[model samples]
Target chain A: MKIGYLGPKGTFTEEAAIKLKKFEKCKLLSFDSIVEVLDAVDKNKIDKGVVPIENSIEGSVGITLDLLAFEYNLCIYREIIIPINHCLITNKGVKLSDIEVICSHPHSLAQCRKFIEKLGLKIRSFQSTAAAAKFIKGKLNYAAIAPKRAAKLYNLHVIQENIQDYKNNFTRFIVVAKRDHEFTGDDKTSIVFSLEDKPGRLYEVLKEFAKRNINLTKIESRPLKLGLGRYIFFLDFEGHRKENKIVDVLDAVSKKTHFMKILGSYPISKIYESNSLKK
Target chain B: MKIGYLGPKGTFTEEAAIKLKKFEKCKLLSFDSIVEVLDAVDKNKIDKGVVPIENSIEGSVGITLDLLAFEYNLCIYREIIIPINHCLITNKGVKLSDIEVICSHPHSLAQCRKFIEKLGLKIRSFQSTAAAAKFIKGKLNYAAIAPKRAAKLYNLHVIQENIQDYKNNFTRFIVVAKRDHEFTGDDKTSIVFSLEDKPGRLYEVLKEFAKRNINLTKIESRPLKLGLGRYIFFLDFEGHRKENKIVDVLDAVSKKTHFMKILGSYPISKIYESNSLKK
Candidate 1:
């Protein structure tokens, strides 16, 4: 098996991918962007792809969500939730005062805002936190906010561990494949749909799930990109798409919606409970 | 009167500020961050502050939403929706082949992904699109994806205009003040609340508005940042908070929510119709 992820390596996505039991013996490949990872899966360059869908502090990863909704004909096969512990890394012997610039992915930088502000250092954004660590590995007077594993991979020293403003920072990653997963007892059905321009359209749609007591885990609206106030609703509900209740809800919703697409039905991820970095 | 905006000048926020008739004679102040802009308004350093609340393509500005929900005591006085047109700016005599790096705010870069991908240029993120233009003002080989006004403001030439992937891209900016505005009958009330974790909790919240036939323009869920799956919902509905129906809904929602905050009720923004880059 071959699995692709967003990386130059040492990213949290890679960490999550490695934790999956099925991919223990699989060859892992890294792509620069989430789009590329999904494309690889679609093109069969890789058997599956792992990309971040949401961050606890940063909310949804829009690019990932958008690609799943419109660009790729892919389905989420599984999910992995990893605790995000951002570490401040720098070249050996580089002290706090020597660091003039800190670089990381924008989300990581934002999560570590308090630490960055306290240091009064300038911020630069890189494609990914691991990429920032790789760039700053042998450099002096530059630091990176990256996963702790990045420090070791990039031969940098951890100047500070768990530097994010919030201690419970976590990112949820989803494995995407060309086909949807078979129904598990505990699963999530993700769907995207657009409603007609009318009052109470969304309420009517939500009522389908509510009346059936089918709980929704998440609901997000993205602009349809046609114009202002035009939106496409993305929803995650607590059931597999094949389930009778879910099928009925989708059938009812489809009749009311202008357009609807089922992204996938996948088993919900178990949260990472270990505080230690090792799995 | 003085208006604070996210700027080092030539930002879309400044354009929105200038369009406001009431701020015609007001001195405009530029702050480096959204937090600073809101802080200035809270401390009376500026009478009002203009900040981007959402982009039609990019969705909600999470920082702005989070601040309104937890940090500041300010209310949204009005909203401004501006069409976002991205321009590729470069030094005079520089050709596309000479461009090595493209810089802009992350959102601007993402909006122009198709154009940038075609060019295959390296991307660098700045604090704002205007700042990227300002930084690349006299530099050779570096181009910026910024508002057309920034090209003129920074003495750079527009290599390309309307470079955003979507032609109808727009950003919604909110004017936050220390107090709320009087209802204009055509007003929007924005509120944030967290429901008790249970099945049908959000459904219950929406029923309150639906039963009254109140229309919700937007609904977004952001993680409370404490952990995954714990979310605070931000809702925008078509009624002023002062209305009897709205007041009753709030009373009912308050009882169901673990926490609740009324950001404000303000007149909805009139979309800027002219496309000539002039107010």
Candidate 2:
């Protein structure tokens, strides 16, 4: 199967994509923009595409939500949550003090702001952490804050590791395919809907999920841009869409909401199991 | 009044602070981070502070919201919505086509994503758009995307002007101070609250605002992290908290909300004739 993700071969998204598949021969394709990655999956350019949905430290990835709203046909088929560990990587012979300016993705820089500020070096930003590490390997005066795996891939030396502001820093990525899947029997579903500009409508809709014992994993609201008095709600719940309880809950929600779109139902990701290599 | 904003010389936030006051000796102080700027105001280290709250293209500044949530003693006193125009800047004599990579703050880069993608050049992120312009002016083979004023400050050549993706791009900055000011009688108020996780509870709360004909300009949410089922809503309304209608609405809605906090109320920003000079 052909898979697409955001990458230049060593981004966290690439790592997550590779981890999602078990087959050795899965064809992996990289795209620069999230829209292109989604388009590739939609037009059958690729069978599925993996993109980041949210980051623990940074909150939700707004672009992903906006795209789901813009591209109405795509559905999420699976979910993966990757533990993120950022490190300070530098060229072979360089030390931390040798660096006058450090570079990395904007999110990474923000996550490690205190540590970087304590070191008194200027912060720079790159498109991705991997690209920053690659640049550090080529330039002696530069150091990069990136993942440990990226440091290894680019042969850069690690000056510090696991430097994020929060210990539970993680990014949730969802795999999207053109057609819907049968929930893997044990799955979760996501949907976006808008409440009429009326009182108690949101509480009533959310009550359906709570009463059914369906736990919500995420909820966010974005402006409809039609001016004031309009909003759209994106939600994630911990149950399969095909389940009777969930179906009934959604049906109840349909009555209360002005517009509702089911983004997808897919297998829920298990926590990552680190590799155990045998000598 | 003494005011704190960001500056070394020519930052956009500095320009905004200057426009906030008419007197030449308005006691302007430059700070480093959004937190620092806000803290100075909360601690009464300064009379007030001005910081960018939202941009037309980039949405809300997440850091500003986070700080506001923690510092309940401070309130939003005023707002300044500034028009933003980014230019492609490089050292003198460098042509646009000659640059292989472009750099800017992530928000700036994202705002111009479509245009940058059309140019088909790699995007690099930097500390800030102004800093990126400064770096590009001192280096080669690079162009920085930043406000036109930054290009002039750094002695860089503008290869292209008005390069943002959206023409109507504007950034709304809020002036924050210690408490709700005694209204000169025409002002705006901000509040944040959470609803009981019941359907129609939020709907009921919204109705109070609607019934009173209060125009809400913005509404945003953040995870309460109180675990599983809580959320906090940030809101901005057109009238001051002291207005009879607004006071009645707040009292009527207090029964429906689980928690409510008034962020403060102050005079709405008046039209500034000098803001037109930035272009």
- How would you encode candidate 2's per-residue C-alpha lDDT over B195-275 as one tens digit per residue? 877544555677787767777666777655343235677877778777789999889877889988888887766534324
Instruction: Tell me the TM-score of chain B in each candidate.
Output: 0.96, 0.91
Q: In candidate 2, what are the lDDT values of residues A1-279, reduced to their tens digit? A: 899998867687887888766623578899877888998888898998989887766666777887887544899877777777788888888877788888887778877877887888777777778888887777887889877778778888887878876666777788888866685667778999988776456666776776677777667776554423356788887778888898899899998899999998877777564221110
Local distance difference test, each candidate: 0.87, 0.75
TM-score of each: 0.96, 0.83
State the weakest 10-residue window (summed lDDT) of model 2 chain A. A270-279
Model 1, B41-154: lDDT tens digits are: 999889999999989887888899988987898999999998887889999999989999999999888888878888898899999999899999778989999887887787
Q: What DockQ class does candidate 2 belong to?
A: acceptable
**Each model's fnat?**
0.65, 0.14
Model 2: DockQ score: 0.26
* Candidate 1: tens digits of C-alpha lDDT, residues A1-279: 899999978888888877765436788899999888998999999999999999999899999988888788899888889888888999999999999999999999988887888889989989999989998977798999988888888788998888888877889999999888898799998899999987778888888988899988888788788877888888988999898888999999999999999999998887875343465
Top DockQ model: 1
